[model samples]
Target: MHREISELIEIGRLLHSRGWLPASGGNLSVRLEDERVLITASGSHKGHLTREDFVVVNLKGEVLEGSKKPSAETELHLLVYRVFPEVKSVLHVHSINSTLISRMAQEDIRLEGYELLKAFEGIKTHETSISVPVLENSQDMEELSKRIEKKLREEKVYGFLLRSHGLYTWGKSIREAYIRLEAFEFLFECELRLMPLA
Candidate 1:
């Protein structure tokens, strides 16, 4: 349990150093073996997260332990666990490339013919294509969650983005989740670099 908390803290520190989690702009969560989730608390800055900065919550988003409130984006994290039982960790980030690409893209950001596209699961080659559904940002997480569920059910998605917001990606572990996030960011950066700034 302590090791798991330390893993989250290390990832948070790494993300913060890369400027992907500026302030409290993002959230992190991992599912415990007993079906509870360890999540960053509300208003807790990922850059300086401690064990106390995290709280344990059930799949229903109710806090079962810890003194702090769960991340405001708690529902989103819970949704991933419910949807993908195999997934153990969730990582959301507010990086410049993901944010700008979300706005630049249409309804979904599609990537193809890139070697990094193989970074996502089940993809054996670059011949495949991936469309990351990008929905408009909403303060109402319930509504946004509903939209994501509908989209996820209709297709195979490694992750999604909130327009003008950020990216949400998950995996079987903290390492896998970070790998996917890093791949997505690199792909987005490549796309951005192809377009000249206004």
Candidate 2:
């Protein structure tokens, strides 16, 4: 538990410093055991997260431990765990590129022929392509979860974007999750740069 707690705090600080998680704009979580998860509390600055800022929740998003409130998006994290049993960590960040690019696209962001595509798991070269699904933003968590789950069945997704919201990515561990987040951000920026301005 100490290992997970410490790593969660470090990831928060790192993401905060990178301008990915600003002011309380993002949430993170790690699955612990089969029934519990460690997740960021609601409304806390990621850059200053302490151990106390994390709360334990069940697979159903019910609070199990800690004084702070679990992030409202805890269900989103739980959804990933329920869908992808291999996922260990989930990171969601609101960045300029994700926000901007999601708004410009209608259904999905098609990224192809990028050298960094290999940064994702299982890809060994830039010959592949990936289309990240973009869902319309909704305040209803259950509705959003259903949409995401449906999409997950259709593609080999590394992450997803919420229209005008942010990016959500996960991995087998905290470090790998962070690396995936970095990869997505880099690709998002590159895609933005390639677009011609009106």
lDDT tens per residue, model 1, 1-198? 798899999999999999999978999999997889999999988989899999999999989999998988899999989999999999999999999999888668788899888899999999989989999889899998999999888999999999988999999999999999999999999888987876
C-alpha lDDT of residue 153 in model 1:
85
Instruction: Indicate the worst ten consecutive residues by lDDT in candidate 1.
Output: 103-112
- In order of listing, the candidates' clash counts read 0, 0
Task: State residue 190's C-alpha deviation in candidate 1, in Å.
Answer: 0.8
Candidate 2 C-alpha lDDT tens digits along 1-198: 899988988888888888888888999889899679999999988999888899999998888899988887888889988999999999999988898999988679888999999889999888889989999989899999999999988889999999999999999998889899999999999989988895
TM-score versus the correct structure, for each prediction: 0.97, 0.97
Off by over 4 Å in 2: none
